[model samples]
Structures are given as C-alpha cells and as structure tokens.
Target chain A: MIITRRTFVKAAAASGAALVLPGTAPGAPPAPVMRAVPSSGEMLPAVGLGTWITFNVGDDPVLRDECAEVIAAFFAAGGRMIDSSPMYGSSQPAIGYGLEKLGRPEALFSAEKVWTSSAADGPAQIEQSRRFWGVPRFDLVQVHNLVAWETHLETLFAMKADGRIRYVGITTSEGRRHDLFEQIMRAHPLDFVQFTYNVVDREAEERLLPLAAERGMAVIVNRPFRQGALTRQLQGETLPAWAAEIGAGTWAQFILKFILSHPSVTVAIPATTRVDHVRENVTAATGPLPDASMRDRMAAYVRDL
Target chain B: MSEWWTYRLEDFLLFSPRVYWRLFELNNAASWPLHLLTLAAGLAIVLLALRRPPGHGLWVAFILAALFAFVGWSFLWSRYAAINWAIAYVAPAFGLQALLLAIGGAARGSLAFDRRDIAGRLGLLIAVVGLVVYPLMPLLFGRPWSSAEVFGIAPDPTAIVALGVLLAASGGLVPLLFAIPLLWLLLSGLTLHAMGDSQAWLPLLAAAITVAALALRRIAR
Candidate 1:
C-alpha cells in the first residue's frame, strides 16, 4: 500500500472534480492538479506561490496580515510551493510573518535562494532566510540569478547532502543569463532550475525547458505575468471564448494554465499581494490543463496582441 | 558582512520602476491641486531670493524647511516607509535638514540673490526648471497627470529646487543645504538607472550642474 507520487496526484486530481468560488461552496475548495518532480518523483501542486515584490511589506502589520490571508487562500486552494529569495527586500521576512499569522501550514514546501559572492557568507545568508521563513530548513535552496553560483552551488550541494535542504538548484528570471543558465542545466547535477517562462517570453521553451526534461530536473517557471507587463498590456481585454472549457475564468488562470501545460514544468509561481489574485492563481491548478494545440493557440493569440 | 560590498545598485531597490513610479502617481492622486500650490510656493521662493529683502534668507529658509518637513512626514514616513526601511532612517535626516535650515535662517545666514555672476544665473534657471518643468515629465512620457512629480510634495523636484536655491544663494551655509539633496540625487539616480527608468539621467545631470555652478561661484569669489 505504498502511495507513489503518481497515485497521490491522481487522487488529488480526482478531488478537483468541480471548481467553487470562495465562501460560495458548502465544502472545502477543489484540490489543485499536482505535478511530480522528474528527478525524485516528489509531487507538487502545478501552481506555486512566489513572494517577490508582492510580499515586501516592510513591517506593516496590516499589509502583513493581508499577505497572511493570501497565503491562507493559497493553502486553502491546495498550494504548497512558496518560492522566495533573500535578494527580494523584506519578502522572506514577510513570508515568515504571513506563515506565523496563518499558523504555519504543514503543506509548506519552502523554497529560497542564496545570492552572495562570498562563499563564506552563503551559509549565513541561507541561515537568515531560514530565520525569515521560520522554517527549520528549506525544501529547496537555489543560486539566485547564478550570481557567484560556483561558490553558492557548492554550499547548496553540501547542504543537500547533509539534509539541511532537501534539494539544491539554481534560478534566473526575466530571461536574464539564459545562455549560462542553459549551460549549467546541461553540465550540473542540479535537482531543480527556475527561470522566466510565459506566453510572450518563449525563449526558455527553446532550450532550457527541453534540457530540464532531458536532464530529469524539476523546472519552476517564474515571471508568468512577465512582471505585470503582460497583464498591463492585456488590460481591458475579454477572456477568450474557449477559456471556460479549460476552467480558466480569469487571465491569471488562463496564463498559468498555459505554463502548466508544458510537460517539463513542475510548477508556475505567480506572485501577488491581493488575496483574490491568489485565489485566482491557485484555481488555475484545479482544472484540465491546455494540451499542445491549445498552447500553440494561446501563443498565437498573445503574439497578435 | 563581507558580501555586503558586492551588492549592486539594483539590490537596494525593493520594487520595479513601475511600482516605484506608481507610488508617485498614487501620491499625486491623493494630493491633487497641492502641486499647484507647490509650484506657486517654488516661484515665491525664487522671487523672494531675487528681491533680497531684509531677513530674506530666513524667509527662504522657512519655506525650504517646510518643504523638507512635508516630504519627510507626508511622502517618506507616510508612503515610502511602508515599503523601504532605509527611507525611515533617511526621513529623520530630512527632519534634521529642516532644523539646520531653521537655525541658519535664524542666525541671519546670507542667502541673497546674485544674478551678476554666471553661477547665480545658472542656479536661478535650474530652480525655475524644477518649479515649472518637472511636473510635465509624466505628461510628456504619456502618463496621466496623477503621476506628475512636483516640488514640496515629491522628493526629486524638491531636491532639485533645494540645489538650485543653494547654487543661487550667497552664503557660507550653501554646503550645509547641499549635502542631503545631493546625496539623495545620487541615490535616486542609481536606483532609477537600475530600474531602467528614463528619468535616471536627470538626477545625475542636475547634481553635476549644481556642483559645477557652485564650484564656479567659489572660484569667482
């Protein structure tokens, strides 16, 4: 009776038979669709939560509480992966504060990054991140933007071996350092790699993603909204008529489903400050994802935009 | 601690350029028509500097002090402190500048209009630019009027105006007034540059011109 990652995901998908809005349904909301890491077969919800600028509240209790509600909504919708970094000012600490207010849900799959040139300071930075998230150890610690990666990757590898962190990886976002990122994905024995991938920014689809699949590394897609550029550009536009077929009621869901449709993508973390946006984001994981043709159509539709 | 020195200018920025500018837009939205008053006040300060009435230094000081205090209380403390922790420490520096200006003015510090010199003329021109031209940046950039940055309400133009005032004034207290504004211009310029903001170069240029004019004035003296 050993339940594998596949069986767990199947059970979770079966539970997501129907979508319900907040406070409108009599029962707990539908569980999100889950994807398994190709490397270790550890399953995670297809949609993860990112804490970049959205959670950097800078000690404001009201804003902190608001972020806590966003976390609450995320977990309530069956989200597990909450990705953050030390480079993002006040974001990690705010995540800790939010988790504190939310009573530290057990589903938390905390992911953080070390961004320092000094190899000696890498452990201290990760320790600070641990303190910030109020977690005993991170589930994943990545090299942010590949800065001093040789130094930090060594630290991450040792931490992974010692179980201080469960997984060691690297990340680049906003399409920066992709050439080097691709090289690392090919050469290194990393467990996970995160980079920017969305409808408009298809550069990752060219090499990084396929390489992740080939290398059996878990892929986390970031900047799914292209840092608000996509949303702002598509503002005032109606959702596509066929969006309802895939259960995408909003653009957030629509775009997230497009990312999740990729076979290599384990999770897409869309950061947000608003609780409603979090609900919208997490609900993207609840329904049938777009297939290859729908993904092509989605790309064409956004290209014309 | 060893890695602290490796940080780039972008590392200090808490948000994107869009979010940063959106703060100015929100500030403008919350305080509409206050920009008009700020424009008028800036013009009045320049005019008073030109008139050189008795205790005119104190008059300009009173106005400049009030502007710093307003930026500290209304903008930095109320708006920015919510996002950036470094600004909370910097807000008190603005308060300190306000006090310094108060003391200099009360002590009859010399801050008279001097248009005969090139530095004086250049300084006055820069001041007027801050008073009139700074607010139009949002409109020129295709942004709504709600994103307009003005003196007394916003930091950039207020700092520029302060530099202009210092450059035009005939006083030993010029360096004291120049310190904080210049530091802010450098910091803001770096931050804006890192954010890929088009206005990034403006602060650096303003800082250069202010310093050059002040240096020219000193040489002439």
Candidate 2:
C-alpha cells in the first residue's frame, strides 16, 4: 500500500465502484469534478481550505466534534487541498488533529509552509511542517509570505526536481511586496504563488496574476474576505440576482466565484475558524464561476459597494 | 517604537537612493519584523507626502515627531533586547508583534462579541491550538532543515498533542490573554533551554516579545 500520486490516482480511477465511505451522507453531496494540471497531470480540487486563523477555533469538545463533523462534511461534500503555515501559528496541527480524527489524512492535498528566513534552513523547515501535519509526502511546499524565499525556493526547487516535493511556491498575503513578488516570478520557476486578491486588492490582476497564467503557475488566493473587511462591508446585504450566473447563493460563493473566474487560479483558500464557514467556503467549488464579462460586472458590483 | 526606532525610521526614509530590497531572502522571520519596521518608516514618508516638502512643513514635522513619539514609546516599553535575529531570538519579537497587531486589528474589526464573529474568533482560536501544538513540532514530523536529511530526522509526536490541548485550554483561560501565550512560551523556552543549546534564549525572546505585544494589545483594547 505504498502511497504516491501515481498510485493513488490510478487507484481512484480504478475504483469506479460505488464505495460507501464513512463520511458520505445518505444523499451524499457531489464531489467536484477533478481538475488536472496539464503539465503534471496531477489533479487538485478547485477549492482548498486555508488554515490560518482557524487553528484555535474549536475549544469545546462538543464544538471540536462538530468541527470534525464539518470536516467530514467537507470531504463527503467533495473538497481537498488544505493550506497551512507555521507562520499561521497553529493551523497545521489543528488540521492534523481533524484529519487524524477523521482518519482521512490521505485524502488531503496537504500544503504547508516554513517561514524561517534562512535559506540554509528551508529544507529542515519544510520537513518539519510535513512531519507536523502527518502527511506521508506533501503535495505542495510553499515558502510562506516569501520568508527566506531564496533560501526556501532554492531548497524547494531542488526538492521538486528530486521528487522530494511535488510542487513549489512563494506567497505574499500582505499585498505590500507584490511588485517585488512580480520580480521573483519573472526571475525563477515556481509551481505556485499565493497572495491576497479580494475585491479590495485587485492589484494582483493587473500584473502578477496574468503573469502566473502566462507562465502556467497555479495561483492560490488568501484573504478572500480582506481579513473580514469585505464581509463586514457587505453585512445586511443581499445577494444580487446577477450572482445567479456564477451559481453563487451566498456572499461567500460570490467572492470565491470572482476569484475562480480567472483561468490562472488553481484554488482559493479562505481561512475560517468554524465548520459552517468551512462548508460555505468549500461550496464555491460546486458551481459555475463568472466569465470575463461577469467578472467585470462582479467588479462593478463591488465598486458600487 | 523607541528613540532608536524613530531614528531608524527617519534615516531609512531619507536615506541615499540606494535602497536594498530583498524579497524572501536569507532569514525570513527577519522579513516580518523588517516589514513592520520598514512600513513604520514608510508611514512617515506617506505622512509627509500629503504636505508641501517645506524644509519640514508643519505636517511633515508633525508626522515625523508623531512617528518618533509613537514608535519610541513602543520600543522603550518593550521588554526584549530588540536585536531580533532568528526564530529563537527574533521570531518571537516579529511573530508576536504580528500577532499583537492582528489581534489589535481583529478587536478593531470588532471580531470579538459579534454573532457571526464566531468564524473569525475560531480562526484565532485555531491559531492558539497551533501555538499549543508548537512544542510538539520537533517531536512530530518536521519540516526538515534539509531535503536529503528528511528521513533521518525523526520527530516525537507524543507530548505535544497533550501539551497543545492543555495549553489551548489554559492559555485562553487567562484574564489577560498575553499571560497565557507568554507564560506558555516562557515555561516551554526554559524547558527547551534546559534540554539543549539550540532551544535557549531564542524561545524566551519569542515568549517575551509575545508577552509585550499582548500587553500593548490590552492597552490598545
């Protein structure tokens, strides 16, 4: 039962048998159709969970049980690709606990970061993150917020070539260093780059994002809520009828749909500390995303906000 | 923000045009603290941008003196010797500073006590769980320092889960939230320092900064 992506995907395609897993409900939710990376043929779920602030969320044993249930719900409903960072403080371990409790760590597309600044230290940090998350081999290893990125990147690039890691990347959530980030993208090869690009920060669209698509790099989004700013602004708001085109039933879905419309984006990971939010975030994966014209209208909707 | 910080901010903004920009270069934990410091400097310039660049216009002087006053008092009040370096020494300073800043932002965001705030609060709480889980990181599977050494470096996953649960409970129980994270880091650092050289004052420095930031956050609250 040696686990590798080739072996796993082979098994998945092999098993068309209607297997009833523990997490699946009676009227089980439909899993998102698998999207493959044309370059690698490796498949990723379109939506992933970001484990930034949600690490400390479930304090009550009951709440945690519910949280675990929500996670069970997430997978049963069809989602994968969980992003975490040690810089995120506690996201990795909390997710580790949830996955372990659910006994489905294998189903996850585990991505974690090592934010330590030393290039010499990047390899060790990535290894530590993998170990902490209890994943057999990480699907992705990203240099968080571009910490010691050169050091981490050099290490990760080598790791990717060696098959020690499958995908490598750098992230910029703060939106402060994106121009510099563009320079990094121009200079080196990377599988992914994460950044904040909610309606509030469209700067990524003008330069870095188009560049990612042109270069064939996967993009993961953070702060889809602008750290709750967007949600607050839209409080007491109604879902516009135009949202129906994107298949968005709620504001969460609308925001995520706006993000997914760009062909370059591989996934959008909005961190939530609660099960409902997790479920809500994952639902964005289910429906049709906005087209170019729709994206423009979505922008107009937000600008009017 | 201290007297030295003010000086650093002023000079950094007004420095000769030769600016050194390193994106995710060598020591990245240094990146965050450096970011905060640099932004603080940037803010000074930003403030000056609005006013005429008189040999120090009223607004420019107000902005400079205000930045100076703000950061100066902040640094003077901070406990750690602010020579931030690595995770052991500097990360606590930067990491906790970021945490405190976020906490301030969250509170300002009125994240606490909101009915729907449950999700955001849960996010921060999850971080607490993560912090509690931090000690076990060495014990658990690791982000190895090197790829070649991945297999050889083993982690002990036993004590950390228990510690995480315990710390998560107790840390959140404290009246002043800083006491919990600060105290946990304190005890944990002392334990690490006792065990090996790699885990010495770095842990303590991290703990101390976290505490100072938490203390300030309380005031900001």
Candidate 3:
C-alpha cells in the first residue's frame, strides 16, 4: 500500500543486478540500476564492490589472481565503485594488482580513506593509496572512522580544491559514535558518508539515513550482510514467493534489495572474494524494488526466521 | 560505550573465513620442500629419543630452535605480518624462544632422555604426533594438501613439537623453553576456534596433553 516511485528509482539505480530492462520483452536481460552522487551529480551503480576483509591478500599472487577474477566479474556485472582503506593490510595493493590484471577497468570509482591521526601523514598516505591503487587521482578520499576528522577533513578539502580527489567524505564502521558522527554530519560539507547498515543492523535508519537525505549527502552502506553473518543464518532457507515480484531469486538479492530499497542509500558495498558471489551480488541490482510496506514485511520475515 | 568491552575474540579479526583459510594455502605454497626437512628433523628427534643417543636433548633443542626461528622469520615475520600487524611484535617472541632453547641446550650440554619412564614415553608420543601425525589433520578437516599445516613450516605443529621436546627433557630450564609454545598453543587454539576452523581444537588438545604428561612425569618422580 506504501508503493512509491522512490522504490523503482533506487532499484533502477542498481545497474549491475538486473540482467534485463524493466520493460524489456519477457526473456530480455534487465538493465542495471544507477544512482546519482549528491554533490557532483555523477551517476554510479547502486551495487558497488567493497574490499575490506575480502581483498587483503598480502603478497600472495595466487590469491591476487583469484581477486582479479572477482574484479573482472564485478565490472562485467556493472560495478563501478571499489572502496578500500589503508587499515585493511595490503588490500589497496591487492586491488592495484587486480586492476592491472584486468587492464585497469575504466568504470572503477576508486574510494579510499585516511586512517591515521597525524595530519602531516595524511597527504603522504593518500599518495601511497594512489600508488597502491595505481590511479592518477582518487574519486573519493574519506576520513576513516572519523579519526582526527578535523585535521583530515581540512586536508581532504584542500585535496578536493586542488583536484587531487573529486569528493570528500567521512566514514564510521564501528557503529558506536553516532552522536559525534551526526554532529559532524550536521556541520561538515561532506559529499558522502559511509557506515554499517544492513537489514538486521538498521540503527542507521533512525538518524544517519534521514540526516544523509536531509543534508543531501550520498550514503554508502557498508556491512550490508552483517559481515556474512546474515547469509550464514539464512543458509538453506527458501525465498518467499512474493520475492519473485521484486526479482529476488536468491537470499543475496533479497537482503541486498532491502538495502537498495532505502531512499537514502546510494550504494551497498558487499565485500566478496568469490566470483560466483560477485555475480550474485551484482544481480541484486536488477528487478522490481520493495516499497516501504514490503520493506517492513521483509524486515518482519527476516525477524521471524 | 561498553560495546568495545563486549566485543568477542572474533570481532578483531580482519579477515573472512575464506580469506583466513586462503592464508594457509598461500603459506603452504610459498614454503614448499621445507616440509620434507621438517619431517626429517621430527623423525631424527624421535630416533634420538628412542635410541638414547648421546646429546639427544641437544639435538632436539637445536631442531626446535631452528623451527621456531623458521616460523618466526618465514611465517610470522614474512607472511603473517602483512595481515596481522600483531605478528610484527609476536615474531620477536619466537626469536626469544629460539634463543632460550639454544642457550638452554648449550648450557646443559645434553638433555637426559630415558624412555624407560612414563614421562619419556608420553613425550615421545607427543613429539611423534607433531612430526608425523599433525600434518594429516587437514585431511580430516577436508582441507587439501595445499593448506596442510606442518612443523617448521607452520606454527601449530612447530609449537606442538617444541612443547613435546621441552617435556621430554629433564632440567629446570625446560619450563623456560616451554613458555612461548604454551602461550602460542592457547592463542592459536582460541583464535582458530573463534574463526570456526575445523582443526580448532588441535592446539588446545595438544596443550592439554602436554600439561597432563608433564604432571604425570612429576607424579612419577
């Protein structure tokens, strides 16, 4: 009953998930959804790739090759954003290796973070991130977990002004400092903000998501699967028949669709190392999105399980 | 505020299950043929213990020292240091264990090994398990040979071997040499369990056996 155009728009933004267009003939592959960046108005795929625990393959060529295939699969499925941080050991270089192997994917929307506290070290770290990612400039450079946010924000603002990075944002994955985060969000001129927000961990729904929408800041949702715990819990469970209406054939799509249905969310970065999982995650972008009532039903269904 | 305090052991791990398991596979790939050398050293120690060879304890001590140093430099420092920054600090602990083992062996001239006793028999069993049997654990857990953890090349079996060697020797210095390996077993066991690893209980089981064997030895004395 709470159907709205926002659902279709958010689902439409997920360009990589749908294999066929919404109005395509019965057998045609659906078009992936796309969302716009709030500040630059640049459209990005709703389903981005995260490289947190998944891409930290320190100096292992065999694993690096595996990650390369995952990247290839991601791009082939319409992924554009690849988020990483210096804190995830060797993840940046691993991404660099994968990109090199994949011939430097043109669609790569590189996002990294400045993690350390020392303001002087921020630029050098960003430079290292560039080298590790093998990029001339970054699309986004965020203050990781808001560590020394004031100091890093100034540096990030300068970098943005200098054309070193296209966007400046702050992130918090710890899920505790919402009060401080909201305060910063209210004050800072951030282009984006990332935090943990999944179907189960909906704490962001009350403040962060609403604030992001109100402030016109793009929201990148992390831990979309609660770090794989939700999948593990839902293992072997059957998808509801109603889910087919939204094109969610698998639980991956079900959960991802729930997140994508949110009006405030720009993208949900689910980190996966397996190529098949990448394909599954990308497919979540396609199909009909759940409306507000359906999202509530989805939440209730998951809770019952 | 109390969330940080409520965090479980698995909370701090920076890797997924697949990535964590892949580490072993990659580590095994990087440290090939060294498995043969470790196997040989483990056998030599078993033979030395069984035959009551002169300076058996010294030989076992040096072998353990080499294994500790190998694990320190190769596994912890070179490989694991990349993922777990804690390895950088922990690598020196292995180095310290190696040094202590070397000094203890040299100062004592030789360890007294008498298989005639219960302690000696139990010690030999523990050592042989580390050398010969431990590598087979991966097979039980449905892991491939590529991820098989072996002594000298892998920390789990290496620590178990060192603990067995320490328990077999008769000296006040044995306890000093036992400290690091004991701590490692507990740490590795808990970590593995937290990660939901199939062989999670092996290190802790080995540690428990080692303590019980040591206690039995004391009772017999």
Candidate 4:
C-alpha cells in the first residue's frame, strides 16, 4: 500500500463522493448559513471560491481534473458563490468546465465580472460569457477594477431589469482612487463590491469594508492572501495558539478566519491550485469565528511578526 | 555556459521584477551592485542576439529586456535604469514573453492549439510554479520563532505540512509535469508578497527552472 497522505485522501475522497449529497452535508451543521443577500434576499454561503490564478490556465486533463476535484470538494463542503472574471485569463471557462465535468454546477453561485475597458464592449462580453458558460442567467455581475463604471453600471442595471443577471456590483483593488469608489457606493444600489483586503492591506477597513456593512451590501474579498505574499510570510513558523482560539487550523485558515471575522466582510475568496487547499479553506467555514478583539489581536500578531 | 541567455531566464525573473524592486527598497536603494550586473546581462542579451549566431535567440532578447527592466536600474549603470525605478518589470516581461511566444509559434506554425497542447502549456506552468512555490516555503510560514525554551507545543501538523512543502522538490517527471499549475498560481503569490505576508523564494527557483528547461529544450533540438 502506498499509504501516502495525499493518496489516502484522494482514495477516501473518491469513495466519499459516491455517498455524499449534491449540496447538503450528511452530518455537518447547516454549513453556517449567512444573512440573505440583501438585494436578492437569497441566503448565500459565507465562503465563496476565488478563481484568480488557480482557475486561469491551460485546460490539460490534469488541470481540468484538479479543478473538477476542487469544485466538487467546494460543493460537497457546502459552498455556492464562485467569483471569477474574463480578465482572470481562463478562469470562467475552467470553472464552467470543472462544474460540468463533475455534473454539479447547479450547486454554484456564479458571480463573474465585466472587465472590458470600453463601455460598448461590456454587454457583448456578458452575453458572450453567458453562452460560453451555457448558463441561461448569471447570478451576479460586477465592474472589474472600476474600469468604466459610469457607463457599464447602467448597462448592468438594464440586464438586471431584464433578469439576465440577478445582481450588480463594482470592484477595485487599486488604492489611488478610493474616494471615487465611495462616491459611487453612496449613489448606487449595488449588491456587492469585491476588492483586496488581507490582514496586511487594511486600507479597506477605514471605509470600504465598514461602508459595505453600513449599507448591508454583501462584500467579497479578493486577493485575501495578499496574492500569496502573506501566506509565504507565515511559512516556516509555528502557528500561534491564539490562532486556534479564533478557529484557525492552518495558516490559511488563520488568515481567512481573520477576514471572515470582520463585521463588514462577507466572503474572503482565496484561490488555490490544489484540491487540498480547497478542503483546508472550507474548514474555516465551520462556525464560531473570531470576535472583534480577536481580530484586533490577529492584526497585532501579524503586524508584529 | 552559453554566451546568450537561453530563452527568458534571469535571476530577476526568478522572484518577479516586483520582489527585486521591493528588495531594492529594503536595502534603502543600496542593492546597486545587482543592478550593474543586470544592465550588463541585458546588453549581453541584445549583443548576443544581434552580433552573434542568430538561431532562435529572440527569446534571449526577451530575457535581456526583462532583466534590464527587472534588475538594471535596481543594480546600476544600465541605460534606462531610472525608468524601471518606478515600475516593476512584471507587466513588460509578460508582454515580451507573450510576443516572443507568438512570434516563435507563428514561425513554427503552431497556430492551431488542441487538447495535447494543453499538456505542454501546463508543463510550462508547473515549471513556473515549482520555480515559484517550493523555495518560497520560508515565506509561507514565518521562520519558527527562535526561542530558548519549547513553549506551547512545537509546530502544528498543518504547519509541518506547510513547511514540508518548502523542501526543494526532487528532480523528476512529477516536478516537470506539475510545473504549470505551480507557475500559474505562483503569480497570485505576488499578491501575498505585496501584502507583506509570505517570503517565497519560489520566483527565483522558477527562473532557474525556466533557464534549465530552455537549456534542455535547446540541447534536445
């Protein structure tokens, strides 16, 4: 028997798949449900999958298989929201393919974005992606990086009115023009806003995160690992005991738990190339998250280290 | 060693131009020594491509330009070192690599891509990831807190799993085959580095793999 941890897990996971339900857990707590998405009034899983680098790639059978395993793991563990974009290279197709391969995309919350620089190009992209994904309607659409929001938002709103998509939102990772983002948020009826907000990058805490909380707008966190730098930072170190106090097991869970603990933050999407990472990430979704004091403590701990 | 860089492999590309840029900042702009090496390397690429035997050296030119932007200014004495001061060479390197691949592929008549092509591309990705992932083990987990007495239990199992991932990968089919997934996700690693989290040496490792792969391919041809 090879008996390697990876092999054992792979073998066990294969058998477990046959016995598991499509979306419901066999013995787990209702997967820690969240408040209904304020705009759509549909409850969304607190955790969503981020498809940045992991999903963006060449569709080798191995890559597709890895993706399929990840999507299957995500759905079986009770995840629904999947944040992706055309700008993220091949992420969209990969997700659709992975879900279709596993025969379980219906258990997904397909939230993608329109990242075109041109206002005229946004709608065409949305329509093209709809056919490409083979989904009759999109669950959510957002302006990527706030490229041409003024024009695109109107088009997105019209799509929402037509029921082509369920919700509309905006996103940005750049810090230079936050005031501009604030202005848009105040004036718009957006359902969500996605952006980078890791423990190190606390710029969003000042306004964006809190503002989303204030408006009851669902907030999605992109680049939660600070794009992998934060994780790399924790490498080779023992996870502090305080981490487990906040419901974190691995360093990944620690970082993710910190974001999930935030009152304003709705979902923190950490993209992973390996299925093991998907499993590790899902573990954080188990209830009893870090409280405010723990979050503050987490900040101090990461900052000092 | 070959006169010109084979394909687009350089010390700077190993860790992303961004890391070197940040490291340059770490030294309070004192890592000027590395910059001089970069400019020379960059010029060497151009000279080797233009003046020497011109087989398929266009990729070498990409490395030359990439190195120049990545380390030239940070090192010192390269022409246009100042321009690279404000920007990391990531974007430019991506564009040049893409152009070189396009031109090379077009020249070789590889326009139509199918399923098997995915394997080769994914191979490139694994090389990228293996280069960027493992060596970065130090950064993903903090260096174990140096202490006199063992407190609260040693590293957790996950920490063990995390740090164990740092060990240099064995040289074999697995590493080469797994390169693309590794490489593709490694770019996201930059996201972590930007946030002052992990301290991955994977990028440097990836660059080395890139060079090795290029050399191997050149010899195989």
Give the winner by DockQ.
Answer: 3
Say which prediction, candidate 2 or candidate 3, comes out ahead on TM-score: 3
Worst ten in a row by lDDT for model 4 chain A: A13-22
Residue A117, candidate 4: Cα error in Å is: 1.6
Quantify how close model 4 is to the true structure by its C-alpha RMSD in Å: 19.5
* Residue lDDT tens for model 4, A188-247: 989988877877787887777666755657788888886676898898778898686756
Predict model 1's lDDT versus the native. Answer: 0.81
**CA RMSD per model (angstroms):** 7.9, 21.7, 4.3, 19.5
Residue A105 CA error for candidate 2 (Å)? Answer: 3.8
**What are the runs in model 1 whose C-alpha is more than 4 Å off?**
A1-26, B1-13, B16-158, B170-221
Residue pairs in collision within model 1? none
- For A1-305, candidate 3 gives per-residue lDDT tens digits of 23245644443343222222334456644546777777777888888999887898777777889889999999988789999999888799899999998889899999999988788999999999899999989999999988889999999999899998999999987476899899999999899999998778888877887778777788899988888888988987878899998889888899999998887788899999899999899889877778877888888899888
What class would a CAPRI assessor give candidate 3's docking? acceptable
Between candidates 3 and 4, the one scoring higher on lDDT is 3
Q: Which ten residues in a row have the lowest lDDT in candidate 2 chain A?
A: A15-24
- A1-305 in candidate 1: lDDT tens per residue? 22234533443343232222223346768777777776677778888999888887665566678878889988887899999987777788889988998888999999999988788999999998899899988999999888889988888888888989999899987677778888888788998999988888888877777677678788899989976668878878888899888898888788898887776778899998878888889888876877666777877887876
What is the C-alpha lDDT profile of model 1 across B1-221, one tens digit per residue? 22456556665677755456667777877788787787888998899877877777888888998999899888888877766767888898889889878777777545555554788778778889988898888877776777788999998899898888777776666678889998888878888898878888888899999988878877887
The DockQ scores of all candidates, in the order shown, are 0.23, 0.02, 0.46, 0.02
Ranking by TM-score: 3, 1, 4, 2
DockQ of 1: 0.23
TM-score of chain B of each: 0.93, 0.25, 0.91, 0.27
Ranking by DockQ: 3, 1, 4, 2
Q: After superposition, how far is residue B161 of candidate 4 from its true place, in Å?
A: 44
Global Cα lDDT for candidate 2: 0.53
